[model samples]
Target: MASFFRSAVSPSSHPSPQQAAAAAVAAAGDAAVKNLSSTFRLPFASLWSQSAAPLSGQRAAAQAAAAAQAAALAHKEAAAAAVHASRQSTYNTLFTILAVVATILITEQVLYRRKKAHLPGPTWTIPIIGKFADSLRPSLEKYQAGWNSGPLSVASVFHIFIVIASSNEHTRRILNSPMYAEPCLVASAKTVLCADNWVFLNGKAHVDYRRGLNTLFTRQALATYLTIQEKIYRSYFAKWLADPSPAPTPYMMHFRDLNMETSLRVFCGDYIPDEGAKQISDSYWLITVALELVNFPFAFPGTKVYKAIQARKLTMKWFEHTARESKKRMAAGEEVTCLTDAWVKAMIDAREGSDKLADESRKVLVRDFTDREIAMVLLSFLFASQDAMSSAVTYLFQHMADRPEILRKVREEQYRIRGADLDAPLTLEQVDDMEYTKMTVKESLRVKPPVIMVPYVARKPFPIDPSYTAPKGSMVIPSFWNSLHDPNVYPEPELLRPERWMEGKDSPAELNPKNYLVFGSGPHYCIGQQYALIHLTAVLGTASVLMNWEHEITPLSEQVE
Candidate 1:
């Protein structure tokens, strides 16, 4: 880490005062002394002879005192020399350390710049924690400055260099080029998610792992999950209606609770108790806050990361315990009730070679996953969806309420699809038929994207553009805000207009596939995107029909938080 007066000089031409005095004495000599009063010399000679003994004794005493003073001065000079030497040694040591540190920091900066090439960014990075303070308190204005700079830009935090791709082309390139780059999430993700989690896998490993889990989000699987989703939403709405605080309180936390409860039920089902769901939901906020862009790396006590880890541990314990119970139930030939049972049944059928149950594709990679492995996968899904789903739910409500006409259209579609029974659960076909609801959900996500950007690490030099090659081990970020809100793609992108996605005419925005990055693009795109969108659409649709709700605009509510 790149971690902040005396002079005795004289002119050579001038003589010292002692030297000048000696020279004057040598020039005058005895001749000048003889010219004095010789007349008084005879009488003075007798007095001088008598006083000679006493004068010599006084001179000897004076000489002895002068010698003692000279010895003391010499001793002081020796002590001063030792102190000067000690100071010099300390100075030399500090200089060497600073020089070494400076060299390392300079080299790091030079290499960072060299990798950047023609990219738009700082020529030299701030030493150590560059842009850390800004990231700690993120702002749209600062992020906009980067996106506006060029297609690509650079930044660093805590010695980790980051290259940001802000343009649609570059952003898609980074997401598609999985061989050159992989998702790193953030600095502390490994600690929070566990290094062994399947979500951290890359290359063939990541593909294989994801393929097995792909069955969980299949169209058939989502149909089953919807049954659980609507039940929770209904119960929560009644609670909200009964609550004392009906004066337009902040709904962000309420939405978080809704999403968390829905997710837990939809994943674990009856295997996890109501108390278990509430416990997980309450503690899950720690994980959400800990996953911010910049956070303390260590999980020391009292830190957000520590609390998040503890919450993770608690959640995982329940997940693994549920998995074990599900496996036992499956072994006893119990019917599948939830995702855990579904997964365990598939593994069992594949192992036993049940021709009716084992599909040809699943048979190839069919093996029983460990309880811990299943728990980790479930936890990974929760971690990815928790905050993002909450954000999407909140904004969807806010946007719909702010525009009541749109909400009216959405409610019309909902009531028509479900008929007179407002409490009836929706099937996959019912969700698909609600075009306006889907459009509303789509527009809401675009206006307030849950994930602003994603972080990826370069395995090797990544030539995202002709001029710029992200260096090995550099973190590259692809920003989504610009892509989603590109005015050219969606005219007046800031407006929450769902008609842009409707099939009125073949407009450029509706015609362009690239314009829609709500679920991202390419091979590493969101796995459960379908499930997530449908879930939100279902929530908004159901909320429209069941409850009378209104959006209260606050001074700060309109601003992107």
Candidate 2:
């Protein structure tokens, strides 16, 4: 049988059924091995071929091995190519990012230098943040150095280019030329005060708005506010005297509280409760802190701007409520008490064509302002007056305390004006009679003007001078310190000599009205100049007679901060 099978399987011969079936099975196994090798491209295909059909499958196995080896080599080459391409892509991405950063940095430097152009500032700014660290902790000495650098010095903070006007002529030009510039308090003013605040208004809108509100500071209104001011002053003086702390404590914040309370009572009367006033006063410092020349732009959580915004919202809520109540009270024919009452009464008279509208210019239009509008106006007054008045009072006390002779003169004048009736209700006549006190306040303001500089924005390319044109959208700051402290204007600007103001019209300070920028100049000058003067005069005059305190000179006494 074996011999027959071999013969049958031998060269192309027909065989018996069993031998044919065996050969067919072997052929099928070899075919399967070839198929598997081609489909899987596996390295073990040769071993499979040998196991499936060892006799006639040698050549098939060899072919399968060659095919599998070729397939493996191709896959290896493809993987290597993929790795090379991936590495190249990563390197290209890194290079592109680096190039973009470098280009931005270069452009920033180039633009800064171009805008700076022949000004006194750093030759090359410290990249994007540019004097940001210096700004964070601004110092009077540093500011003086910059102002002394040149008439028109330059600086960049967070890409906001600044042109500081140190000379009196240049400063006044920037302030008076509203056509080329307008008040832009600081980077964070609009954010803290709201963009639509009246203080932010420009051109005709600001003028008209200011005109309508001028009556709030009229002589009549000042008289009314005086009564409220005296009561607040007496109340605070009592509290200060009652303090049990034997050791000298810093009264800076106490003076701030006094000013805030006085301002609140004068602005809104009893509309704001004690707790509310305290809350507003505490939060107001955040607003002051955030008013830096340049601040972190975003109002992120825990940031100064964010805290100030929250404080503003809280304060505005009370102010708006006060407005609504004032309107109702004025409509009911109640006696005017605060500035809001006076304003609301004016509006009512203007609407009714009442004979009380004595001055046509003081009369409001037929259109009535909403509570929010009224509140915003009141907020503006507080913002404009609060810190400045606080500084005036604190320094006034300190200056007088430091110089006993000055304090003695102030007391003598207070006694002469009131004529031994220290507790008498303060009147406009009494406030006016305190001329020495007024000069003291003015001199205090001059020696340490609460507002050292007023920041403005160039509405266009401001030709601040023939040599230098401040670029459009740049900050053009008018510094009052240099002008107020100019040795040329006042021979001894550093000394707190109130008699300088008493020298009448020919005095250097009086002759150069431009130099006395205590209340600023131009259309945007402090509208409440008279009101502020009167307020300070009344507080100091009253304190001179009614209370006595001393300033203990500590190491930090002279520190401006």
Candidate 3:
């Protein structure tokens, strides 16, 4: 009751108990202040009162700073834990990657050695690079060494598996059985010839397409090509005469150029302008150079593919031009002259009347061929003729030069067939009647065929023989050189004697079809076989009669370029 009465004095009065105690103490302090103020005669009491509130505010601020410091330490600890977890995760990932890489490398090495242990090749391949070093510039001797390794030997480089089929039976099995092997012409084929060309076609499609091409090389067509061949040879022979020296230059390059020019003229006739044909002939070497067994396939500006693509474009343009012109001329009812003309006339004849078959005299389907299709056909002709014809012509000159005695007989035969003025064009019948010249051509091709190997693709797993079965997708190369040069069949295999074919012992045509894989043996054999021989016979016969040449044989003369 007393405390209530005392505290009710005013609304601003302090509370009782502890409040009263504080009030009493404050009253005492006020009294003391008043005393001091009286003694000093100053405003010090007010100054003290003003500083007390500010001191209380500063104390609250100090407490807040302490609390903030504790909170900051907790946050720092949490951040440190997060960083530690991230580092641990990264280390685990790195370890896992390294382990996988090591495992893969070990597996690869083990498998590589295991496969190589039984195969017949170099005792040791050049590490991971394998035979790449030797493959750069392959040699006939090196190939022969590999061929002699075993009847069937395996080689692996850059994961590619190559099986060498050595024996004649094994080779024939590889070529005839197109179910386990395929031709792997260098990496540059896709670049040199477009991917669309029929030469790259495989399986039954390739076989059927090749069948259609046989009509283009019929005896009549071949006869027509021979006339062109004779005319071209006579013209080039006169150019050879301008040299005036008895000694002959390399002549292989000259012969190659002549063959290419003549091929172009025969294929295109006057439809291809002279300047354009010359340009194509000159630039065609780019395509040949890109045809090495191995090459970089990138089409970047400086790559082999890029250069080859440029050559293909040039050739394609001329081929398409020839097709257009031939079509126009054939529509006007002109006589078929060159290959292009013959093809166009056939197409027209098929369109007009009864189904005109491409096979010699047989009329079959009257299908119309596109301009591009015709171009692709011509491309096949060029592919079949270019390298093969060049090699044959070069060897023909070489054999003639080396065997002057044989050359004398050949010249005499040509003179007996054609007069001393050998400038006259040869008829198809006249060319076929030159039995001796034909025998010489056949013998020359047999001794050193322009194409040494025939490549075929396997459609599936093929059981080639009882002991040897080619693995699917492997390049089982069948080299015809062994078969063509067999000792038992030819007796003196290395010797170039045309009389062996002419001797009444065996029908050269029949006994040798199995051995003469020069044009391949099975369904996909060269369609232009007859035309090729006819052209060769005409060139050689004319050259023998008109031109006198010699060979400057180098160590590399007999080697493939």
Candidate 4:
């Protein structure tokens, strides 16, 4: 058994032929199997490992694709949500804005209607800026329509409610009721004239300040102003005669220049140089233009109010300097020559107890005003008198030229007063004695009053009548045109008849002093009433004597601007 096992185990050992053949076949079969196993082992293992790796990579790619898809879906959902929220927020904001605007507009109308009350204005105001367009280009026809609407017609401008008083009684009430209202002038008056100007002072302050100024318009002061005025009138009249223009020209501006020079000389004397006077005269029209009923409220550059402010500054410079110089000369005991000198001397006399004052009623506790204060007062005077006086003088000349009969009578009266010596100086007594000349001035002023209305502001709720109460902060305007032109007050009111003043005690005009609102009425009535009359009388009287000019009637001669 041991031998047989050795033979089977050792193939290389010798054996029988049959056994060897069998062993060879078996060995060959075993060798083939071993070769096949050796060849396929590494290839199958590599295929299995490579296939397993690809499968693992494919699995990783599938997981990554699933994660990317999920991220993309989340991003899309977030974008849609963000868009929805954004749309919601926009709608909310727009709705809020619309609601607020609607509320404001509704509130505006409600407030306007409440303030309008029962007055005779438009049924509904022109939203925000009512009547602003009409104010920009004011016309007499429109004003008349408004006045004819009712005695207390209502209107609004820039949300500011306005009440217009057209009847004589209502106009006078607004003027006299100091407890309820005070002079507001126009919307721009406070800005053009400084807010702190003495003219804007109210109540006792205004009274006290005005009391001290009465001395400047007395009879003695008028005589002094008249001398200076006469020199200017003569100079201007001589220049007018010397002009080489053969054709008729517009002398309105020339008259304005003449008036400006007269006013400056009367107010400042030689203290304002000729060049300075010309500069102020040339620039004064800016102030006039800026003082319209309505203007841009601010003093921005290149605006009318701005230009007027610059002009005011320039004028005040010279005026303040004049005040300083006049104070020095007055303290040195010089004769009073100008308004500034008169004021300074009055202050000095009041301090020294001099009895030169006209009366006790005119006397007041005078204070030493600063140069700026004195300058401001003079500026107020110029602001008050310049334009009105210019218009008066221009119309006086035109009226005299148009009606030679009137001119003949004026000339006759002038000659009768001065007795062929036209070059002689004038006096207040002489001015007073020319009753016909005074009547002409009064009629001229009545026909075309320089100021048609005065504006006042309500300090509190004013019971203007038993029916309607003027709201606080509202503008109350008193129109003089209707009252002055009332047919009952002056029959045929459109006609310019100086004889109406000469009609004596029972004359319609003489019986009703309230209708004469040319210079205004009540506490704020023109303080220079006597001075204005005297000035106009003297100017007309002088012109009637010194020179003669003709009026060339155009189609526009009878038209009122």
Can you give the TM-score per candidate against the true fold? 0.85, 0.87, 0.78, 0.89
lDDT of 1 by residue, 1-561 (tens): 000000121233465786556445544543354544465686799799889979998999999989989988998998899899899999999999999999989987887677667777777878887888888777788899999999899988887889998888999998888899988887788898899998778777777777767777777778888888988899899899888775768888888888888888777888788888888988988887887878897899999889999999999999998999999999999977777877887788778776634364374437779999999989988988888898889888888888899999998998899999876678899999999899889888989998888899999988888876788899999989888888888889899988888755588677777857778777777888998988998888888988877877777776664
Task: Give lDDT tens digits, candidate 4, residues 1-561.
Answer: 334544674766667887777767777777787888889898999999989998999999999999999999999999999999999999999999999988977887888889888889988888788899999878778898999998999998988899999998899999999889999987778888899999998888888788888888878888999999999999999998998988999988998888889889999999999899988998879999998878786789999989999899999999999999999999999999998899889989887778886454235535688899999999999988998888888888888898889889998999998986777788878888999989999998988887788889999999998899999999999999998899998999988889999898899999998899998887888888887888899988898888889999998676555
- With candidate 2 superimposed using the best TM-score fit, by how many Å does residue 532's alpha carbon deviate from the native? 1.3
Q: Write the per-residue lDDT of candidate 3 for residues 1-561, one digit (tens) a residue.
A: 335544554465557687677667767776787787697765676788889999998999988898888789888888898888888889988999989877866665665555444657655444455677777877777777877787666665555555666677887777665545656576667667777787777778777666655567767777777777777777788888877777646666888888888888888988888898888887778777777655676778987678777877888888998898888888998888998887777666666663556443233325667788888778767877887798898898889888998888888888887776566678787776788888888889988878766544445655655754555554556777777877878878889988877777575544756887788765556777787788788888877776677777778777863
- Please report the candidate that would top TM-score against the real structure: 4
**Candidate 2 lDDT by residue in tens digits, 1-561:** 444545657986666797688877767776787887687776477677767687567888889999999999999999999999999999999999999999998998999999999988999888889889998788888998999899999988888899999998999999899999999888778888989999988888888888878878888999999899889889988888888888888887888888899889999999999999989999999998888777775689999999999999999999999999999999999999999999988888878776655554444444599999988888888998888888878888899899889889989988887886677898998788888888888888888888888889999999999988999999999998888888887888799898988898998878887788888888898999998898888888888887778888887677674
Give candidate 2's whole-model lDDT: 0.87
**CA lDDT, every model vs. true structure:** 0.83, 0.87, 0.74, 0.88
Off by over 4 Å in 3: 1-119, 123-128, 244-248, 355-365, 419-421, 454-459, 505-512
Choose 3 or 4, whichever is better by TM-score: 4
Q: Each model's RMSD to truth, in Å? A: 17.9, 10.4, 7.7, 4.8
| Full-model lDDT, candidate 4 | 0.88
Error of 1 at 341 (Å): 1.4
In candidate 2, the residue pairs with backbone N, CA or C atoms under 3 Å apart (3 or more residues apart, or in different chains) clash, namely none
